[model samples]
Target: MTQVNTFQLNSSKDEAQKAAFQLSAPQDDCAVMFASPHSGRHYPDEFQSLLRVPLMDLRRVEDAFIDQMISPVSELGIGTLSAVFARSYVDLNRSETELDSRMFSDGAPTPAGERSPRVEAGLGCIPRIAASGQDIHVRKLSRDEAEARLQEAYRPYHRALTNWLNLIKRRCGRSVLIDCHSMPSLVAGRRIRTDIIIGTRHGASCDEGLARTVENHFLALGYKVARNIPYAGGYCTQHHGRPLEDRHALQIEINRRLYMDEDTVRLKPGFYKLQSDMKALGLSIMNWAEGTRMLNSQRT
Candidate 1:
């Protein structure tokens, strides 16, 4: 294990109402950073007042407790960044440019050609609908409202992420971002439910070996692991993953059914076991990073 002091800092409520995200750091930095962009549960009053759907419906979209699942990484001397604002408020994983024009009264800045499939499905940066297809807003929003969310939440989160990754890289010569998420047990018609899915955008986001290492970690735990099936990584994986540049990003999606009561959004009996397994996984990755450092030293 990497030896370092243990420190955790949460934003003051008065400063920004518990910050847009919580950053936990170890005394000595390592090559890995864990991020949970969708696990946020905070719903601001202004955002809640416009909702057409019930709060429970919006909660369905959260990765729910995933941040807590990966919280063990901080104990292993790896840093973690977890969003405080709910994903329904503004998705930190999405590109700021992914705006759905139809949901805004003033029209989106993105051209039709630039709209992604996610946007078409109403899962853009500012979501138009929940994962269950319920319209989120009772009325169309002004462009200013959308922009404000991005300015207040989205950009700052990414800025902090980028800064952390860069600082880690400078200290360790490389950096890896593990973007954590959770998926519903059943996705409409899908029958071959997997316990875990690791996405590297078909090897575009991170080195194939790194992806395989993560896959193997889960497989070793006797869990059914799939690669790039329904999910092949998202914006965070695509945007930040650059293996050639010594910056790698991977997305890990845990089946919500594995650790939480899906309908109630509560922890399952198996939650502790799952968390322990993930902690072991993080330690394995840290060992791999140590080996990489040795290899880089040998080459030099």
Candidate 2:
């Protein structure tokens, strides 16, 4: 059994446990799935009860319109799984085990190991601080509350993701994952001039050739490109990527300023062009999948 068919519902009862993620291509037609874990914007009422800072402040942490940006890829037979619940509510990019002991009533479902640097910085699976460094909840959460978010949001999303990837592997002989995300144009008050950053976990997550090919696509499109600097991907890239199993995961970070007004959290005139470019990017991956499938047949 793969990671798929292994996770059981942690149901402390989330309102939309089954509906939190939307999978557009259940058929797995192209053997590629574009997932946007941080693009979710929905803030549940139960979550609203925990708010300390204004919601807009928390919104800054979102990948913003990345879900919509990757939506077009489904048209080309790439499965798309979009998390609809807000990342501030429960970051899907993080490990459910990455908890902050201080955030919970009983010191959390505390990690059995030392806390990771990101968790210490308050960016765990259940985030403690907003993008602006403001606290998210006014009070410490109950152990049940923390577990519910993990069970409801984190586990379900991964369950569906793993199942889909395994299915693609079984049916197509290869599986590809394009983990979609957006980065702020400015970090720590400095501008990031690169139009895109592609991360393959220093080639651990994917073959260097495929990573280079994807990077070259954006570069040929006149976009400045960077590799593994500042953002080298997160739990998703590290966990799902299994090159030995013929499964590859690559993370693409789009500069938000290229498509949206950051302060207002609204799309700019550039969003459409970028959306179009995303469709092209998906097509490129599909073409690669086809070629890879053909080569595998020859090898066999």
Candidate 3:
């Protein structure tokens, strides 16, 4: 039997258990599903001692508080899925086969498929190190240990996501999986950058119409939004997005500097503003998806 994790969202005499991911609805039938794969913070104590950097610094790569922002999307009548296992523990956006041979003592079998540049950079299914290129541990882990994590953490998250997407598609006859993520405040010290990056794998992951609807929402808010630059989607978007099948996936990357103190990792004064903007955008996207054929539209 598959083990399911039970969490409470509201008052109810009877309890229900979902998988590691969660779903909330307001009884409104919306065809969009929101997902935050790298925003998890449930780090295991056993992995703490292995970290070469401080715990606070270790989380510099994490999409801090993203779960808090997207959690309310459920109340807007859409489904929201979030991973509870920290990205440092196991990244759900990566392919299950993306194991780093160097991270294991006996080495690992290479994954099938074109070797993604991200995996080559040590951000594979089993990352060799955390962000900042800091080594995760002092010694190489056993292959069995790596495989165990794949079975226990990596596989379950994707399995849950797949099942959820399948259900949404069944009900709506079409579904959009917005894979939510947050990027570093500054990468290689670029002074000016995009406020949001909506990646559709350069139009392979989602319909152009859907992408335009999302992109316009941010543009209407007067926030700078870019397409397929710096980020053109990651594993989640690449793996699941299938516009031909009427299931589109888009990767939405919000700049961390907008809502949080990059150094302190705390919500900034503009945090509420950004959240409000997202709320408005979310509503617009939901409404647009309900009545329009976004699959037929294009931004430029």
Candidate 4:
């Protein structure tokens, strides 16, 4: 069993010290890190009490078992960071400034200028609705409540992620951050479906070659792959990716219908095959990283 270092938050001041993510270190340190920001299933009792929608309804926003699909990557000597709090509670992928002012009773501390298209879409840092479009809270939250979630959850996850990547870069001279996620099978009115979508903010978040390598790997395996279509990465990918600095970030959106029952959020017969494919992909990524590092060294 993989050892997970979990961080639990309490309802008091002392709980604020706990980190917001569960990290599984690789057996051997490498230049790659995998992060599953939305796969968190741990729902704090406090957050649960505030929910206006059913628990199942709120789970619609979750990436479901996406963390598990990529957890085995640690065995390839790549560290894995997964959130311990659900995205509905506090989206780890969103920027702290992405808070929607309308969702709060006292108004947000930050100005509306920080609001982006995502904030308008009801999918801001503190979401206004579940993935199913159901209201999340019975009433508007206080600004303090929103701040607390960010302090306890959002900030720590990103802090740890940033630290992990920086450490990997210092150790290996370059680092790759793979932001993993799962998308709902039925995206608004789409008959043709892709098995995987790799987003690098249309080549701004990572090297074009790296994104192509990932796309080609999935394609070679007979999986339909797309790049920056409906999804072109999110806050994490855009914020962390610094191609000029040798820090690459890639957002991978897996189609939930391929491996699990999206409604029940359970594994199906195809789960094992998907998991196997992911591990293979992870190895391929590591090999590519090694090759890139060698090429860079030779150039130097």
| Candidate 3 lDDT by residue in tens digits, 119-215 | 7887887676666677777788777777766776677778877877887777776778889999986777675478999999999999898899899
Model 4 — TM-score against the truth?
Answer: 0.92
- Candidate 1 stretches with Cα past 4 Å from truth are 1-18, 109-113
**Pairs clashing in candidate 4?**
none
Residue lDDT tens for model 4, 204-241: 99988788789888999899999998889999999989
lDDT of 3 at 235: 87
- Local accuracy of candidate 2 as per-residue lDDT tens digits, 139-258: 999888988888777888899899888889898888889999999988888999999999889889986767977898998999999998978878898988888888999999999999
Report the error of model 3 at residue 204, Å: 0.7
Per residue, candidate 1 scores C-alpha lDDT tens digits across 1-300 of 432212222212333444677788643557888889998887877788899888888888899888888888888888888888889989888888888888888877445414889888888898889866889998998878987888787988899899989888888888889999999988786754799999998988887768878999999889999999989999999988999988899999999888888787889878899889888888888888778778989999
Q: Note the Cα lDDT for every prediction shown.
A: 0.83, 0.83, 0.75, 0.83
Lowest-lDDT window of 10 residues in candidate 3?
A: 9-18
lDDT at 72, model 2 = 80
Give candidate 2's whole-model lDDT. Answer: 0.83
Question: What's the distance in Å from true for residue 221, model 3?
Answer: 0.6
